[model samples]
Target: MEKAGLAEFNVKIVESCLVPPCLPSPRATLYLSNLDNQPLVRTDSNVLLVYEVCENVLPDPAKTIREALSKVLVYYYPVAGRLRKKEDGKLQVECTGEGVLFVEAMVDKSLSVLGDLDQLKPSFKQLLFRFPSNTAIEDVHPMVIQVNHFACGGFVVAVSFQHMVCDGRGVGQFLKGLGEMARGHVKPSIEPVWYRELLKPKNIPVHDLELTKEKIESTSDSWIPLIYKESTQMSLTLDFETVKYVKDGIMLECLDNCTTFEIVAALVWQARTRVLEIPHTQNVSIFFAVDVRRSFNPPLPNGYYGNGVVAIGAQAIAHDVINQPLSYLVNMIKKTKMSLTNEYLISIIDTDQFLLDIYSNQANIILSDWRWLGFNEVDFGSGSPVNICPIYWNENGPNISNGFVFVHSPKRKCDAFKVIVWMPPQEFNLLEIEIEAITNKYVVNGSNY
Candidate 1:
């Protein structure tokens, strides 16, 4: 139950069944965005949230959820479908009105048994969320839900979604709506929207190939850390005050304004690239995502839910990133964000179909900011989760390689963010050393610690 001090769970899937959409409708379908089709193969979005016991009982999760979701699916019907690839190998969700995989389970323990819930490491996370089977058909269910109850009356909700169907924000919307139903709402507080076509790439697919290097996906599951063996994943939490100290120090360098993510991401990027001993002269790149929902002139629909974010790159030599002041790194990320334009977004979809390639550059890092995504609002009868997280790797394999970090707040109640990362153990240890020194050197004073 402890080695990295992570407690193991006795998982037993008592019930495994499909929750098909409630209403009957014509077979429907959705053309996924180019952004959706390009990420690696078989990358599914898996999330787990734990809620303490509730005082009320009428809104019993069992009865309330099934009844509510049966209705919620009537409108958000595509989620009940499966993914099908065309002759060109592009993906589209086939809305056959097929049911989504839903499972009920038990853990035979209390929530507190797994202490320090905030820092559930990747190895421990794999135990909660189950990935799709590798031998399953290509056309797979886009969503799966697993509900597990503990001896203390506490429970955890595990949700998984094929990445091609929706992005992080979209996942938030779905779960939040389901929560409203379980809490006795007439329907989803905010109507679900599907204007994904807005993100479709131009017919010709124009991209700046000169700046792009194609990377093929690796079929090997080398990233999985076996039980009783070393782990390939690591998770860390950074409090708000520490984050602010780092941000203020960078701002003092004459940078006008720097957001939290930009500053933190830059620091991690610099730390990983430097401590990992990447060549000082070799170019290091950080891929930062921007939510395009509001980037349009008139703006996308208020409820438009789909893949609305795109990742832009900030590339510079490692020497500059390591030697330059913090402000330099912040500015590098800022420029990348400001450069995002409608035309640029459109051009990149076809940008040599680059989204389909594997990104294997040893010095590259991908950072996704989820602080603003409303994951804290998912309140099913009980209160919100004490700790909630998104899983990057499942039973199949790692969706992304080393150097991918997901940044999100533990909850809106606290300003601190739980930064979950996937990287090589040796490199991450070096990065951790650099992080500790920098935080003491800049985030907080050594005497204060």
Candidate 2:
């Protein structure tokens, strides 16, 4: 008989490896997209997926997983290469197959000692994962994985990737392949596809849009996310009922319109604006990464394995955003999504400098939804992960970018959403109050309980 999960947090290293791709991939340079080269997006993407394996049920799980990774890399070979700048000053992966980093550690603790999974913080990451010394693309390994074994028989698997390589959905595909191989599947359910040529900028790049230029020029030094006056992070939990209430409330105002993302994002955008108390005349914007894989004229391959997303900007005056009703904000968000046409994507790709300008100077809120990434499917034989913590769990960690992430909460009794928000402490408190108040406003179906 054996206990499951973790028992405590005391940890120590046991094994490690520099696991390279099993087969040498062709030496080539994989290009980066305009969205990829943004100063804001140039951070190492790190994540922790925790699972509870029965005690001694599997021997040398680390080595076994490493072997699976090697095979997986043979197909997803670019991950094993290094990110370098070419003579043209563009970023690309030099497919030298230098190998990725994998580490195995043993912890004197168990999941029980770690306390609630939903309350995961930076300490949990520092203990269970192998964090890169820095977030620099050249400094940190583009890819790394850490396997930790707890005394109570549970283990945690963490993976860090260079953001320049792929987006979240792309990474999920790779992880799924790794899991399938670990489970004895020779090939992945969806074979790897790298169509980098599909997103190449058009000849004589077009920068004709006035809106793009206006939005790009809106950002001033006043709102630089880098300048902080006691910034903080808040990990919030929202149940399905509360979310429904929000949706319903917005529907009333918009005549059966608005999405959960729209409502929630509108609230967050407005709340942050309110908290910041910026001048009414000043301009503000919200940024979202639109998945253009399907929006392209000739859609990308089903399993296209590159950064196939474009950054969309939603802008308005501070006064308008703050004074306008939530529906107004929601409508703006909806419009932004509706505007990501094939042509718009190419326009951004061609003269992405304008978009890049906005991204570099604006201190706007960047929200990326991770609920649909299917992280639970990253099973490596023992069992599906009990919890999956997204990039930068807390404020003190590396690359605390001025962005927020939405993830599925591990709420036992019901479905819920967890929004990881990075903002000033005062704003977070205010946003918390606003969030509760907003949910309570239209709780027609027992949402307040």
Candidate 3:
């Protein structure tokens, strides 16, 4: 037995054990050095993190799966902590703690279709929806990877984590390291880096960025769990060329340069707004996650493990959003993108001091774009998922309307992208005609269109 790998693993375990217990809450205390200058703040509120694991070895699957997860947890321990506020005005954790506090593992009975990536993707999503919130952070143990062997002897591994500790990109890097370890490739080239000093708030005069105080206070209303009615899966293939055509039409009409995500998102936003028929004076917001890896000074290491993204939103009145041409919508989206600069992100974080105040009067109508965010790379050993959908975990019922759109690689043609949207049934119906029109236009225009 090559003790070398074990020795290296032990080193990580010891380092995690030595992390100081200092924080207002476990969530806010742990900070990344690389994201020091940037606003990578964690909220006391919990977030769900999910991943799909593919494996080739299948004998005695349950035990094998558990063993793998156990080893992975040893590396992820320090990053697992709960967010808490102290009685005094200070923010820090009591320095007397050890072992895992906010990680768990459980079997999802629905993941039996491990061999079929298409079916497995959707099933995995539903699994995230059923995750319990009452589990003790101290007892929550990671490596809850589940093994569901398919009829063909292949198996899928689903690992869920709390987003309060790490961001998606951070988890992705961790999984890549774990995969290498499982494949007998230890001593990863990329070492994990922990830098909390950089994240400390600046003492100099902070700029006052202009944002709707009312909108900032209303995020709580937007946090409600989405309501779903008659959800079904559909598959369609639109290659990059077709995607480009649709994007071009939206840009030409909107009088602005819009990314593929912006165009598709504008379409969905318009469609949903139409169905909801919200009051003209009422505003709707489109929320999207922005990756801030490169936004930091010195930049995060390729192997950093933690949350490193921020949520940015664009708002418009219901009538303005619904009745606008695709081009105008695209322009609106473009402006929203430009507004998410470093100063804007910092201003948003500053508003966190009043989260409860803002969330109390939040309005309805929010959209999340998961298409261009690299969520489809969930490959266990079989292959990448044909479709990956997001599950809403908020406790409150839909606050009017909410939706998530994911772009997946087409099963028939890998080069093409397939867009699958999840939303309230009525909204889906309203957008059906416009969606078809866009698709039909793409077909008629062919590659050139």
Candidate 4:
């Protein structure tokens, strides 16, 4: 087998020649260039082994469209293995033998812009809905960049990634890197950095333990994982300016110090509670994924990749989040922001025993704000996306619906920050009413509704 040149390889030509039966299997050995070319991340040994697929089809040549996405994948070091604790409390990366586990690319006749922007919104949503069910944390690659031609003589580029691998901001960094590479740049926007050492559990003296034995036992027993039902739906873009004005109005009236995200999220949470009408006293938690690249010790180096994020959550009696004044809701969200500190993040990580304990608990609602996160910059040679949204998933048994809202700043004046909220049909309807009221209020105030 001929070894491909690292760092200076072209993806398109590689894809055409690297067909199956000749190319290395997707399960082939995973190696990092700086670390003895050893595998650092490995799949869970419990799952059934399956081939991973990467679809590649030629799009009408745009100045920037690459033939294959292999170049992008090659840049990131594959997880050779993960360090796990032994019975003696030592960490080790358990390496499993590897070959190309999976790699397959198909060219579909489906045009990227087979429908109008509004129509394309759902089409994109459907693509997200098609995420493979068997996705494991390890199988979920760090990045997947896709570019497809549209029937309208244009093209669309979409990137799907595992949330555990990178946050939305990290995705922006990856896209920027691809853009630089397509432009013939020798180096990425930021040099890639991998410091798994930062994730190592700290050594705590047994005599100085603050956690009680019962607390430790309870924490250990809390690992009982529960499954949840997940679904994804989409709404047309919301009036960004109007929504901002509405949020501002609510903030001013309530005299609260909450951000727009908090206000909007609170409104959605309240509406969801109304629709679900769960007992006001029931414990309800609302969590928003926060990018923590800057929250790490010595702060993650500019291009540090894998999963630089922490979930910032606000839990309270369902009634408080629902019936509380907008100001109060804003304060709750503000307080949540304070929890993004390094101590809190490390504490959470440490207390959870270095991620050994995974939280399978499902929140009634999870709101992801993509508007300010820069999803619009995901240009793959073609123009920006006409619409973008997230897919749904059922984790254990509890019904979990994911909502992603993005802003659409097109070349036109009428271009508003379009919001597409994905939720169960009934929940969406209730949210629609609240959104409409806010928009209507903006119109009454003579603002851009």
Q: Considering summed lDDT, which 10 consecutive residues are worst modelled in model 2?
A: 1-10
Each candidate structure's TM-score, on Cα atoms with residue i matched to residue i, is: 0.86, 0.88, 0.69, 0.66
Highest TM-score: give the candidate number: 2
Location of the lowest summed lDDT over 10 successive residues in candidate 1:
215-224
RMSD of each: 4.4, 4.0, 9.5, 10.3
Question: Measured by C-alpha RMSD in angstroms, how accurate is candidate 2?
Answer: 4.0
Local accuracy of candidate 3 as per-residue lDDT tens digits, 1-449: 42221111100011112222222223334533323212223322111222333454435443433343344444554543333334532333222234232222344222333222222133333232233556543344322333333333433344454454555555555555545444444433356655545445453334655564664554544333333533433323446765777776655665666677776677667766666556676767766666665665556566555556655566777678867666777777677667656655545444432122222222343344445444455433334444443333334422123434445553445676655444444455656766767556745765553
Q: Give the TM-score of candidate 3.
A: 0.69
Write candidate 2's Cα lDDT for 1-449 as tens digits: 23333333556777666788777778887877766665545666767777766542556678778999999999988888888877776688788888888888887767665543444444566553444354455655677888888786777787877777877888889999998999899888898887676677775454445446665655543655444534444567777777787787788788857777888888788877776777787778888776778898888888886777666768888899888878888889998899877777777677655355443443577878887776767878876677676645433553343577877775352487777766566667887887676667668545543
User: Candidate 4 residues 1-449, lDDT tens each?
Assistant: 32221111111211211111121223333222111111111211010001111132224433243422334434543322223334653333333222112222232323322322332222233222122557644443333434433333434444445444345665666656655555456556576565555654464333333332332222222222234233344454555566666676676666654566776777666666666666666766666656676876668677766556554556677678667655566677778777666665555555442221113333345555666555555444444444444333333311234444544533343546544454555556777786566446645765632
Per-residue lDDT of model 1, residues 188-265, tens digit only: 888988777776655654455333442122211123222212335556677777877877777767548888888788
Better of 1 and 2 by lDDT: 2
Model 3 residue 119 CA deviation (Å) reads 8.6
lDDT (C-alpha, whole model) for all candidates: 0.67, 0.72, 0.46, 0.45
User: Per-residue error at 264 for model 4, in Å?
Assistant: 1.1
